[model samples]
Target chain A: MSLHTEYSGPHAQARSGPQVAAPPPRNSRHAAPGAARRFLSWLDLKAAPYLLVSPYFLLFAIFGLFPLGFTLWYSLFDYELTGEQEWVGLGNYSELLADDQFWKVVVNTLAMFVIATVPQLLLALMLANALNKRFRGQLFVRMGVLLPLVTSVVAVAVVFTHLYGRDWGMVNWLLGLFGIDPIDWKAERLPAWLAVSTMVDWRWTGYNAIIFLAGMQTIPRDLYEAAEIDGASKRRQFWQITIPMLRPTIIFVVLNSTIGGLTLFAEPMMFYGGRIQGGSDNQFQTVAMFIVEKAFSNFQYGYASAAAWLLFLMILIGSAINFMLIRRIGGRK
Target chain B: MTTLTVRRDTPGARRKRTHRGGAGSRIWDATPLTKVMLAFTIIVSAFPIYWMIVIASRTNSDAVDIPPPLLPGGNLGENIVRVLNDPDAQFLTGLTNSAIVAVSVTVSVVIISTMAGFAFSRLRFRGSRVLLLAVLLTMMVPIQQMGVVPLYRLMVELEWTGQLKAVILPYLLNAFGVFLMTQYTEQAVPGELVEAARVDGASTLRIWWNIVLPAVRPGMAVLGINTFMITWNDFMWPLIVLAGNPTVQVAIRNLNAQHSTDYVMIFTGTTLSVLPLIVVFLVFGRQIIGGLMEGAVKA
Candidate 1:
């Protein structure tokens, strides 16, 4: 496209050295055409795509790939605040592997994953199906469903914390209406997980629902019509038609939520605070929180990096397993 | 909407609506009622938000009532005053920080991704295929997981530990934006037109400016809003990076910590944080979904 143009604007093409505009084709033919003309066109074709892709590569190498290598390097050495260092090599990983707290964190993560993710996916699917049908006030309802994903986790955590509070909390107040007493939510493990998971399900269930809704919307109206002709009821139609058709999106949300769930932080950290360092006593201290405590509270950067790597390995392996599960589900005949 | 408004107005529209809504439709679908199910879902889903507003408008004493004030009260001003007086009251500062960072990151991302996307999808260049794949792979890497340790250390070393740039710089060129822009550019842009512009004596930049950008402006709008929201709502990265300075999200964290004793103030502060996002939704909600679906289905 740089055949000819005025360079007067901000988005204008940058100049390549002292070259003036390439001479017009007529002038070029009259002047010194053959080899140079052939070369320019080839260069132009080659250069365009190169110019297109360089930005991502340049940025990724510096920011993406380099940081990963640095993380590995940091994992090997005993980095500290007191300016002392020693070669740890595999020592950090060994320590993490043997630690009961590390395993507890893993179990905590998986438990929360099962609790929060399963319900989130199920409710999202149900809501999306319900929403796909025509209705009164549909726009308002759709927008309402999405309100939570738009809010920050910190905001969500605070709002839910208020709800989960021991005294005067809306949750406890509601339970009192059922003749139940106020519970000290943050003091216990199960209550804390329930508190954090409630926040997760509230915020994300709708986000996933929107994705499912989008998937449902595109299932081709004829698919449902065909299902109806086969004498399928609405319930049967949902499982047979909607669930099957929404498979890819179901997988997308699963993988996306798995990543988010495994790296869970903020919501739980704020929920448990000092309880996190208590290890076994803390039921909800996921691996990410465990790493955060190692780095921030204990000031063991090398140990923290090891913990982080171990967690990363778990995510990679879990993600691979999830890939298999999704494939099996998606590939179902 | 037209159906909704015109239906009841027609004496006959109610009968025609038999194929769809109303109590009888549920019977046709079966006694396993749909509206009842939907209403239940809405109540369970919407109660927390309703409860937030209810809690935010009452005093600590009133907030702790046996049957809490389900109705809105006149204590919003007092709640705000208490929330403001609290030592962790960085919400106003955080609001501005969020605006600055989200806007800057969105602008940079939009401009760069659009240019890169245009180049990949329309203007053919060497390794464009390989590079697009690389960009896609980048999207799958879950950067927050990978960047944690290095990013924290880098922030510390650069003396950006408590600065807005700590959050802003790392997020500028997100992979999702690149992927989104690629989809938009491919559809909105065409090769023949780009070639024709070049043939008509426009420079590469001129082709992008005069031809490509106008075609992709709708996309730019979507990408801009999505990127803004992503940056604005980011939690873990900013939590680790900035120590003293608080973005709106980080400020909400600080507020939660300091106002641990006062649920009403925390509720009020959270409500304040949500207000900007609500504005974001009102303005760009329709286009944001379209953008997200486009990226997802295409990928």
Candidate 2:
């Protein structure tokens, strides 16, 4: 990384600006006599680099940064759609702190994250191990795993909503074959959480498995051979070699999963039969869903902005912990 | 513990020992347990999609049957036609709207992200490091849900509330896209190539057009497909901005709401919505999988 940085310095200097390139040596063989050519050459050298990079910063400022800062500003007032704005001065945050619904939504989000991410990552590792082995039809199996990832989250929710149907759903029917009663997946809180997490897990496990598989491939094959010669079983090699070598990848997956899982919106919304609210009783409503509900449905812009800030703070804190965990793991070795 | 020291044990002989056994060893090495586990994974992976097909292929009555037609039924064509002709959902118009928005945003995202990525990777400028760090830091912030209120207000204030541009404009600049392109350009277009071009009096734009762009073609292709898919499948932002003018996802959601009791139409609409991506994935599975895993590993 440092080498690349140092390498780019001189290259950047060589073509830093068109003004420098416009002045030719007194007896240069190639010289542009026309003002147009010099101007074009100058634009190419000095202006193009900045022009190339300006779109992102420009759009990001207008759409990304402005809206975020506006949210912070909007949180300070009791603004609602089609209503007169009034200065509240941290009133929304105070109300949000005391609101039971806000706490419930936060807990619901955390529950879904824990429920979805734990098994998802574990199964991803196991699947990656299975995939890393050379075999017939390897490409076919690999593609099969990624099928869910490529499929849209809304589509997955649509299909799983059907599967989790009370009476005629495939899952319940399979359970019936084993003499278990049908489950009203969406009506009950635990069942709804499970159903939503199942959708999350199904979509992500394969994607993460591919990542883990990539990490596993980076492990030298000779290590497995050495372990084999020492009479270590495949399981032992996985425990002793694969897991430790995969620390960074594991950290990456966990942090990503934490973020993705916490901002749970689409699945819960769709799972609740296309309603924005999680259920009839708000059993499975996540913080994101609540924010949307408050902003659009209830038209409480200030309150929703406060909730959004809370969500951002949770993400910031969670990410910091994950970052520190990565550092600790890195420091240990 | 000795395994950690093994890298030094045979530094020069590493190449000789890489392929530990012959092809015969691979054929006889698999155990029953591993095979069963792999089979289970394959089934789990493919079954939901297969189930979607089955549900979409069946009629309303057949779909609600106790066994629920394990295999796809014979009503696929009829169901698809019904779904397209359904007046309430506007599937045909939604398809056109989705195509326009997705393609427009994808083209712009590819051009902008590639240009910015090339500049970041190859060009030296003041505050380049800080700018790169800013881009990466933005990735950690999930702003979609949080920013909806202000974004909605902005669109309304600009009289863009019901316009597709309301959805298209905000998403053209993606942090991941820039990061991916930068990483790819670094490896794909070597510094020596840029240095050589500079020595030959090639301007920055000239080098970018003649050298860097051609070198990163594969990366551009992957980024294009990824962007198109993300734009096409985007729901919440489009849901808020587009309002009554529906994209494909909004159309599918509308179908579900209007035909709440009719599983056939809902399933059919979803199947139609997912068909293009499925086809794209099938055709370019290798490149898509390779690109995604490459990005993940690099991250």
Candidate 3:
């Protein structure tokens, strides 16, 4: 703990500042001279901050940074759990491009991404607006909105699967009461997409609403008051004031929802009975689920790595486009 | 910032055209139609969870009935006991494993993020700004599936592939946690306090421990609960890492896989697994929501 013995380096305790080194205690007058020399090196200002902050960076290098680099490296090899990895050098990428299943999964992912994220953001905005009002039981309503988000994805999926069941499911039953024919939610493409998107919307709408609400709170109340004074309808004020002011928050919600939608795995996986292939027809298998299937189920690490890289690229591009879209929309104002 | 006032000031009147309430009044006041819409939305939001509990309370015969029970049945105790006693599910073990992982990860993240966030926010260290930027940049990069392949390999190399520590260790270095603490510390703890502590011959560690930690309790509470919820809900990573030793989510998956048709048992297991979180949310929902909203505002 002492600098005198631990760090005998030249610049260890040779600080020019008055408070750099604490003087020896006056009560320890009879104490040995060496005791005064032995300052607590743990208190060394130059080294202490680094020591305090090192854990996060160190862990990041191992778990985060290294894994990012290694994913790219691993994609080039024909790797397996037990077998020796061969130097494939873009072979995996070529195979992924040619794989029809991969393209099908990509199409499915994009469709589901749009289905889930679009309505989710729209609904979230509306819900945020509604909750931002001066209503009785506001806390109760807010908590109710967040209920889906609090529940585990596994639980949500399980419950939804029951609700979307062919015969006894509540959804079909409800449809029946409205004079509509019962549709098989899982087997059919459109029904399946709707069912899954419903799950996504149910879980996330409130969360995004909270974020939107936060953004809305920051907008000065005077803006709304002024708009009201001008005889603007509530709808007009919403379109003109609320939406424009919430641009940054909307962008955040959009980008995050894109990322979340693209990587959706659990809800679909559990809905389709815990299989990587989302359904018998593979109508809802996301790219993320496909990657897991390739790596774990099929034992094709190289192929999985390639798919993973593709997903990452897609997200990067998606985020860039989202950012530009928001910027353009903001500029139009 | 002005405190929000209830625009409707009429105590006894149900309907009033309050001209003095300002321009935002039309939007703020709830119409009969708005009430119906909001009520419907709230129902849609909370109905599934209510439905889950209903299913859990029903017997298998009651559960699979043509008109599935909309109300809670009398078989709650029986189903819970059956789910707990199921040979394949291992509900208790999975709960234990999840708790271990969640608690460990939460504790570690709070401590590490606090220290790192404090340093970045308060300490004047060399390359601090660059390091902080690096931390922020990591938040944007999605943890893709390929990264897991390499991460799994790293765990294998360290001979920690199947352990809870493997799951706990990587999550401890959350970029969001670091960013959350950094923002919280900047606003909550004054720079002059840190400077005062430094001038008093107190170590940086002491300042963080005795001063910064106590000051950021609310932030830490939010961070801790969020981390716990995430860790508890984590499925894919735990499934991959703890391959043989499945956590609660994986166990629930396996439960459904083996039983295949036992809806009552599956719902029971799901309910049991979800109960602890429901409890946590009920207790700390306000703090968690407030913290998240506050963080969003700062961002």
Candidate 2 residues lying further than 4 Å off, grouped into runs, are A1-44, A325-333, B1-30
Docking class of 1: acceptable
Q: Which of the numbered candidates is closest to the native, going by highest TM-score?
A: 2
Taking the tens digit of each residue's C-alpha lDDT, what string does model 1 give over B1-299?
Answer: 12222222222333354445454333224123556666776676667777777778877777778766788788988887776666676777877888999899889888878878787777755566777788876775666655577777777888888898878777864777777777767666655567555654455776778888888887898788778878888877777777777787777777766666677787887777777887878677777766665555544
Better of 2 and 3 by TM-score: 2
- Model 1, A179-284: lDDT tens per residue? 9988988777677777888889999888788888776765656566676677788888777767777777777788788788888887887674323452347678
- What is the lDDT, from 0 to 100, of the residue B179 in candidate 2? 82
Tens digits of lDDT, candidate 2, B119-183: 98888877778888888888877878778899999999899987889989998868878888887
How do all the candidates rank in terms of lDDT, highest first? 2, 3, 1
Considering only chain B, report the TM-score of each candidate against the true chain B: 0.84, 0.89, 0.88
- Residue-level lDDT of model 3, residues A105-130, one tens digit each, is 89888888888888888888888887
The TM-scores of all predictions, comma-separated, are: 0.86, 0.90, 0.90
Give the CA lDDT, 0 to 100, for residue B42 in model 2: 76
Q: Which stretches of candidate 1 lie over 4 Å from their true place?
A: A1-45, A273-280, B1-32, B85-87
Quality class of the docking in candidate 2, CAPRI style: acceptable
Per-candidate DockQ values are 0.27, 0.44, 0.38
